[model samples]
Target: EAAKVRLADGQGREIACDGVLLTGQFTPESSLGRQSHLQLDSGSDGPKIDQYGRCSDPAYFAAGNLLRPIETAGWSYREGRRIGSLMALALCNQLPAPHDALTLKYAAPIKLGVPGRLVRGELAGLQHIQLRVSRAVSGTLRVRAQGLDLWSRPVSALPERRLLIPLKELQLPEHLDQLDICID
Candidate 1:
């Protein structure tokens, strides 16, 4: 038999409890991605993908919260629609392959960045870069590439909240090996 759990408030007063319910350490279901040998991001524990949602295997594609878990259903639906269209284009040979894509990395408080990489010519179509933080922070979020500051903005971020950095405002160089995002 399991030991009975006691309930209590901040006042140190005990409250009666018949049973305890536990839930909510949700994670992405990525067993398939793993079995397929897809590269996974250490931070998100999801498949690494490019802007078009293409995984390391050109034949495979991933989208929605599968790329980064725990987004609103609506956000997932929207992402599905967008990436679905790209997938369709790919099937029709209408989508161009990414030849100049660069990886986007993060450190410390930053949990993950969606799309995982930056695709050269596709930057014009990218509206924003979605960022998830590992903890609550209040500071300037900065993006740098090749020792050059690309973008920075003051932000107060919580682990549960998603941050958006407008891509249009950033003047990223024509060629970059990697882009880094962090709170400074």
Candidate 2:
């Protein structure tokens, strides 16, 4: 079976594949929170929350993608578990006021991808990029300014290839707390 979705441009198209995969982007769907008179802050790439996973409203709490856009599934599960514990304590009247430091330290832009490039002379070939994780599950990728890297399993084992192109990390003002990727 096929499915078709009308785009904002009013163009018509249909997918001939048997299955479709959807990716999550940063689009705040906090209408419920807003309608309920809860404080809303769309300043960050994701929803704003204190360390305890509490939203602007003391009674309302949030977790997962609703709070922040994390690429790894492991981080989402951890956040969910933490929020659950906090909610349970709040319900039992055993938890104190929430603290941001106590909340999980989430790494922004969990995934990075680079595109293939060709240069001349010594820099003609592609540079070898490597990611070294400081923690068991955390790491940094070292690559040239412009280079391409793959981030998917073998095609024979996986139907699609996930390519991760490397770009430079930017230094933002101290006031900002999130990472932003600017692709040229």
Candidate 3:
């Protein structure tokens, strides 16, 4: 089982594969907003939006992967809900509250590879890799892995006095040694 990939004229080509999974990249499709004179912030690969889902233009707003590039669908839905609320409040002429983005702290997906022999270990035979996450500080999220401790850390610190957890990531740590293992 072998696969070959080729690129020509900035296009991709694939050949000789028993099974091929084609996935499309997340592309910002703000053409409608652009046509409506909305200012889109293309700072990164995806469209840029404020914490409140407000685009560069006040009249326009965005959400989901189109607004910001995120790997998880859970985050996208949460963003949509937050943006929807902001839009509704704005249209109602009521002083819309500020939007505070939530931090998504989850373990990275496990990678699958060919099976290999385990040499001299407490547990023998096939072994699995796991990710561990814990709370180091009161408001900080730390991620750790097997044989590693706290490689990545994200601060859930918010600027506003009010606490709004757009998603579960904003929730306080459950335990001292709790590892959040999210498959896909």
Off by over 4 Å in 2: 1-26, 44-47, 69-74, 98-184
Cα lDDT tens digits, model 1, 79-108, are 888788878888887665666678889878
Ranking by TM-score: 1, 2, 3
lDDT of model 3 at position 176 = 31
Stretches off by above 4 angstroms in model 1 are 1-23, 122-126
Tens-digit lDDT track for model 3 on 1-184?
A: 7566667667666576697776543345555665665544432223334344555454766665564332357755765776687687668855233232222224322211011111122211112211221222223333333323433343333211111222222222323333332332
Q: What is the lDDT of residue 45 in candidate 2?
A: 31
| Candidate 3 C-alpha error for residue 183, in Å | 29
lDDT of 2 by residue, 1-184 (tens): 8989788999988978888878643444555665666544433233445544566555867765564333346755875787788787678866445331111111222222111111111111112211111122323322212232212222111111222322222222333222222211
| Reference-based lDDT, residue 68, model 1 | 77
lDDT against true structure, model 3: 0.38
Mind sharing the TM-score for model 1?
0.83
lDDT of every model, 2 decimals: 0.78, 0.39, 0.38
